[model samples]
Target chain A: AQSVAQPEDQVNVAEGNPLTVKCTYSVSGNPYLFWYVQYPNRGLQFLLKYITGDNLVKGSYGFEAEFNKSQTSFHLKKPSALVSDSALYFCAVRDRGWPSNTGKLIFGQGTTLQVKP
Target chain B: DAGVTQSPTHLIKTRGQQVTLRCSPKSGHDTVSWYQQALGQGPQFIFQYYEEEERQRGNFPDRFSGHQFPNYSSELNVNALLLGDSALYLCASSPPTGRDTQYFGPGTRLTVL
Candidate 1:
């Protein structure tokens, strides 16, 4: 089974400071990892994904994630945090060999990120 | 172009009642997937439909069902609603073939009383 873990339930960062939201995964085969952000009452917005290639993957809204195979982690990062960056973050993983890749997305519980000015 | 869209932004239903949620895929998308998200939790997959057929389903019970139209739009129907069913229902769309990324809709908030 493919699973994702977000150790932090919530993270606080001051505005303009760098922010990092941690994520780790467990999968039998190669993993397809994704990061999504959710605003209150809204569906998730894709941030980035790591399939294969460069360890650092850049994504929308000036966000990026590092894929560390040895650590089994893919943590989201941003150089400067904005107050508007506050939202719920989710880490998801899927098995590369899953027959129906679109059927299910193993999601972490989610992390609430708060950026204070 | 419009992204994924869902109807009935909010709904309230009583136990034992039935409800249907609608979703229109993105302009060029041919597949639709449904997910249920409880407060403070990540979304849970319900099912996926492509070419008017259910290609895959999650671990949900039989009470949860769905349909897809030839045009690629989809509907999720839940029978015998329970309080546990209360949550935000999200719809996502993507192309069935290749490395298409899934795009999501704002979601419909369902409240079972």
Candidate 2:
């Protein structure tokens, strides 16, 4: 079965420093990976995606992810973290095995990033 | 344009009670998807509706059902709700091509007591 893994339950970083949220996925075929962030009491906000073309995909709010096919990883990163950047992050992949247009997605457990001052 | 919207920002219900949650797709969107998000976990796909029909369903039981209207709004019906059913219910909308990205609504927080 296709699945995603976010090894860290929580990541702590200082404000103004670089931050990385690691995610790895396992799928039968080429993967359509995505990143989403959720703030307290809010629904998820799309960050970025890697369908094809670029290994490095940039997204909203100064976020980007690098997709590595060889390692089967798509880790989200930011050059400088802000206190507002702290939130729950999720990695997801469209299940290609399903109907081409179903839009079903398998998501990782999620990683909480805490940026302190 | 308005983003996806869900009604009843929060709800509290007892076990065995049936509940209906509504969602209005974003303007110009034709597909609506429902997901269940438990505390500390990622949202799980419940189902997707297109053209007023259920195009696909997740592993959730039949007790969890839904309907889509001509206006592209949707509703999720949960019958005989269990304590486990208490979670954040999210509604996402996509364009005619369902394979594209999904934009989520604020979500309804259901608390089963």
Candidate 3:
């Protein structure tokens, strides 16, 4: 079984300050981690993914995430927060090596980020 | 090119009524997936359609069904809807192969009265 956990229900940050949304996962095989953002009444937008290689992966809207294998964590990060960045964030994980199988993403509960000016 | 699109931005139905939601995959994309998102929760996968067939399904009940057309568009049909069925239904599109980054459409908000 594969699953993800985002401990925080909400995160508050001041504008221009660095922000982090924590995510942890449990999977049987190599983990393909992902971050997605969702605004009210809107669908989720892809932020970034960690498949292999570098621990740090940069994504759209000046957001990034660090994948720590030892910790089984993939925490989303931003150098500086923007009011526009305030939204709901989700962490998801999928197992690799099953190429013939359709990928099924297991998602966390979700974390709401509020960037205040 | 237009991104993934879903029809009927909002709909209200009574309990036991059936509803159908539509989705058009992004340009040049061949795969479509459906998800159900409850308030304040992450989107939960309903199923994935590829090559006009249901390739994968989640833990949802059989009352939740779907179809994929030859043109790569898809429809989600939920029969015998319950109050719990009210939520935002989202459609996602991704390439059949390679990176597997799924782009989402603005979801259809369903309200079951």
Model 1, span B49-77: residue lDDT tens = 87788877888999999999988999999
| Poorly placed runs, candidate 3 (over 4 Å) | A95-101
Q: lDDT tens string, model 3, A1-117?
A: 788999999999999999999999999877889999998878889999998899999999999999999999999999999999999999998644234335767789999999999
How do the residues A1-117 of candidate 2 rate in per-residue lDDT, one tens digit apiece? 899999999999999999999999999888999999999999999899999998999999999999999999999999999999999999999876345556687889999999999
TM-score of every model versus the real structure: 0.96, 0.96, 0.96
In model 3, what lDDT does residue A36 have?
94
lDDT of 2 by residue, B1-113 (tens): 88999999999999999999999988988888999999988999999998898988899999999999999999999999999999999999888664568889999999999
Model 1: lDDT equals 0.89
DockQ order of candidates, best first? 2, 3, 1
Sort by lDDT, best first.
2, 3, 1
- Itemize residue pairs with steric clashes in candidate 1: none
Please report, as a residue range, the 10-residue window in candidate 2 chain B with the lowest summed lDDT. Answer: B94-103
DockQ each candidate and list the results. 0.60, 0.71, 0.65
What is the alpha-carbon lDDT of model 3 when measured against the actual structure? Answer: 0.90
User: Clash number for every model?
Assistant: 0, 0, 0
Classify candidate 2 by CAPRI docking class.
medium
User: How many collisions between residues are there in candidate 1?
Assistant: 0
